[model samples]
Target: MVSTIGRSFNFQPCFLFNSKTVDKSLTARGHSWLWPTAAGVGATAPDRQIRAAAEQRPTWLPGLDPPTYLDGTLAGDYGFDPLGLGEDPESLKWYVQAELVHARFAMLGVLGILVTDLLRVAGISKIPVWFEAGAVKYELANTGTLVIVQLLLMGFAETKRYMDFINPGSQAKDGSFFGLEASLEGLEPGYPGGPLLNPLGLARDIKSAHDWKLKEIKNGRLAMVAILGIFIQASVTHVGPIDNLVEHLSNPWHKTIIQTLASSSS
Candidate 1:
């Protein structure tokens, strides 16, 4: 149980997935240029202006197209079975796949803000005492967030379900259910390093209770509490495709990922 439960959490297409997904994502790399970090200058407006200016240069290679990353990953994976083929497929396959996952992973760092809030509210575990004292600790926490974002963007997941890695089970399985609870306990140990609790499952558990009305009516304290908890968690969490400038600049992990994959293509 790592004290930094929420520490390295990120949300990217490939971060939660395995190698196949990573392979697909890398194929979309186009631009290899990186904007070097500048000090003292504002990071927003001038950054945008610089980017716009760079875009006009006809010699510059284009950045990865979103549609390409989205569709490319799928097409490359489906068309060429990298996992089954092993290292037989062209090295370019692995290269593109890695970059794809990396870029998507970088964009997923938006989740860090909420994870930080969660720790501040109710952190799951405590850090080791070796570095728990004052200045070291705060810096460590901030550094952890950056590391988490970096690792996530770099797209190397230790735990990925064969089923979900191939098939994302966003909804409740078994058809009769719209949540994943009955299967929570059965989760492979050490999987994803997260508690298998399902908020949606909790809501579904008491559906038949008191003819559903009483359950949904919020009369029961248990249900009310569960509902409130889910609300607070969701309200604080922002889950969606990343679409912003601040998010793009802070993504150092992805920049390196693309570079590695793009280099492979050559």
Candidate 2:
């Protein structure tokens, strides 16, 4: 009887060792065999299948694979090409540059609007409302000539930028005219870094440059949204964003966007 007990104990330990080895192998393959109950089995199959599936899942949209083009090379790319606009490589490059340009413009626009409104609020009566600035009467006698000259200058600059984008490194950087270089040697497509751009050397290294690019894209996106909101608010209320904020602050209950719209409709 003592001999039989010793054999049984040895067999039990060997069986447990094999079971543990099998569990480890399964776990390594993204599976579990610990739970053997009916409910556990029902849950395990789906979970295990998902784990066994391809790893390249979409970040924004669940259960879908990310686009082939969105390999996370761009600064702010999150595989967000729902419309498949950037499927083509060349088109994707152009869109990336275009987005950067638009974002910069949007940031500038939001800054201008907010600053103008804040100045007006601070009793700067000379500063006209941003939306109404176009309609404000100018004191200049030759306004048409000024507009024409401005348009010509802006058109020339924009055309040069566009041509450079189409054929990068084509623009001369001899800096012959007033220390002006149309394109820099080591800058990105839209970013024509010269003595005037980022002169502080904020992005000195590769990692810092990438970090700055990410920050710029994020802030630019937020600025674009803010500018859109400002336009919508201006169109709806016929007032500046700061005025709207002041009204809301003064009377939170009734000065809200929804309440204002309801009252206007009523």
Candidate 3:
């Protein structure tokens, strides 16, 4: 699984950012490159499209292309502020080694399992035949994803706290860990004033006990999401007919590969 993540899945940094026609691309660059927040680098074909789109925008930002910013921060920083310079070499290196790799492995393991699973879900592959693991499929996948989900939540919670500690403040009473603050916090503040104040103080005010609990809760939520995705992907991956025609392919996971392709091979 670790090997697959290392060789197959490429982790792409993601920021939950969007834009209208209002401002420069400033903060967008740095919005999501945190440890656990790294989404897949993105689909290769789509990445090319994204790059093409950014190229049409402005080079006001340098090093925003593939060969340079392997993590795609340049595109994130483009049209924005001082530009998403990312971090110093040391930190950047750690981000890749520590965060990116972990995320990559966890996410890919879930994905690989799901890829193998899709065949059975869509009626393309049926039980009472070869490659059918029966109910065991669901059980094993659920068990595996449960671990991933747990680890994911743990990863996110630790990541959030680590970022919080390294950063300078509270996350606000509202509870938007990502900083949407009032708009996104779970428990609303007692009064309207909570909306405008810097959350760092409130974040700092949290006791160590509560903080640990909060971390656990956040991680638990992420674990739930990962489990859900794994479930869906598991079913979806097996919903194909390719598994029946494995003799035509050359890859080790032939059934999975053929099923993933858009069309049949000769």
Q: For this target, which candidate reaches the highest TM-score against the unseen true structure?
A: 2
Best by lDDT: 2
**What TM-score number comes out for model 1?**
0.19
RMSD of each predicted structure? 23.8, 13.9, 20.7
- Regions of candidate 3 where Cα sits further than 4 Å from its true position: 1-94, 97-156, 159-266
Q: What's the lDDT of the predicted structure labeled candidate 1? A: 0.35
lDDT for residue 58 in candidate 2, whole number 0-100:
31
| Local distance difference test, each candidate | 0.35, 0.68, 0.42
Model 3 compared with the native: what TM-score?
Answer: 0.21
Q: What lDDT tens digits, residue by residue, belong to model 1 across residues 1-266?
A: 00112221222232344544434433346321221223212236675565454345322124311211122222222122223333333554444444444433333332343344344434453432211222353643686687688778544332233234344452225542334335553222212211455434343433233343222222332333443443443343332112112243577666443563464558
Per residue, candidate 3 scores C-alpha lDDT tens digits across 1-266 of 01111222235543366534424343356533332322223234675676566456444334333223333332122232232233355454444334333444455554554555465544665443223443355544676787788899989856654554344344443454665556433221111123344344354333333453334334543544675655554355543233333433555564454464444323
The segments of candidate 2 whose C-alpha lies over 4 angstroms from its true place after superposition are 1-58, 62-64, 140-142, 175-179, 182-186, 204-208
Tens digit of lDDT per residue, candidate 2, span 1-266?
Answer: 00111111211112334454555565556554453323334246675454334244334444343464676667886667656777788888888888888899999999999998999988976688899887666878466777898899989867877877887766645652344664243365676665467576556454448778989999999998999999988888888998999999999987898997887678
Q: Which of 2 and 3 is ahead in lDDT? A: 2
lDDT of 3: 0.42
Q: Looking at model 2, report the run of 10 residues with the lowest lDDT sum.
A: 1-10
